[model samples]
Target: MASFGWKRKIGEKVSKATSQQFEAEAADDKDLADDDEANWVHATKRRKEILLEDCVKKSKELKDEGANLAENKRYREAIHKWDEALQLTPEDATLYEMKSQVLMSLHEMFPAVHAAEMAVQRNPRSWDAWQTLGRAQLGLGEIALVGKQTRV
Candidate 1:
């Protein structure tokens, strides 16, 4: 009788262990299925190439307007327009160059130098920005000389 009872207990333990293992395997399979579904959803989304092209076109238009204002000798107004262009595309070296030129025309030498420096910072490959910076520095030097002469 004692032997029979021990055998029955062992059989019950084996059954519970098998049930726990089956539940763990089912959970892992469900997680894998969820991951596959997420991947499929992401693959079906549309790309945004056209929107990017439109932004570039608008930036060019604003830059052209800034140039027109500068050519008309409206330096402050040109700077305002260039500022708008910069707001649209802050990484544009040409817009910064235009702003620097406009500021220089208004005799705002320090601000001109700062704008040129910003252009170089935004695109270090721009020779135009470097030239503008040099010219602005020369203007500042002349102003400094004038101040010294006046002090004498």
Candidate 2:
């Protein structure tokens, strides 16, 4: 009877120690995973930020070159430069607006309208885009579409 009691006590002690070791290991693993996740997230965010900065810088350079070309009356070259800028910033309403004006200078009515429409779509609240769209529509001989007379 005494021997049975001693054995039971030893068995309980061993089980408790094993459980504590497993708990400690689990905690360490969780800490490692959390650190790894945090590092990965931070790196990804920084990489995206760097890429956006680069794109904005390059787009600006292209836009400036295009504006200079347009000012010099090199309409086709200006259009080409603006097109490259658009590739970097497709959602830029100003780029589309500039392209629309260049196309108008070239008497490309269809393309001008298309570019103006794209500008309007990208910036619905922009007065310049709306004005460009109206002008392009008028140039395309869509005077009826631009306005209609109503009896007062």
TM-score of each: 0.61, 0.73
Model 1 compared with the native: what TM-score? 0.61
Candidate 2, lDDT over the whole model: 0.90
Question: Across residues 1-152, which tens digit of lDDT does each residue of candidate 2 receive?
Answer: 34544334545557887988988999999999999999999999999999998998999999999999999999999999999989988999999999999999999999999999999899988889888888989998888877741111
Residue range 62-81, candidate 1, lDDT tens digits: 88887887898877777877
* Stretch of 10 with least lDDT, candidate 1: 1-10
RMSD, every candidate, angstroms: 10.1, 7.8
Question: Which regions of candidate 2 fall more than 4 Å away from where they truly are?
Answer: 1-37, 148-152
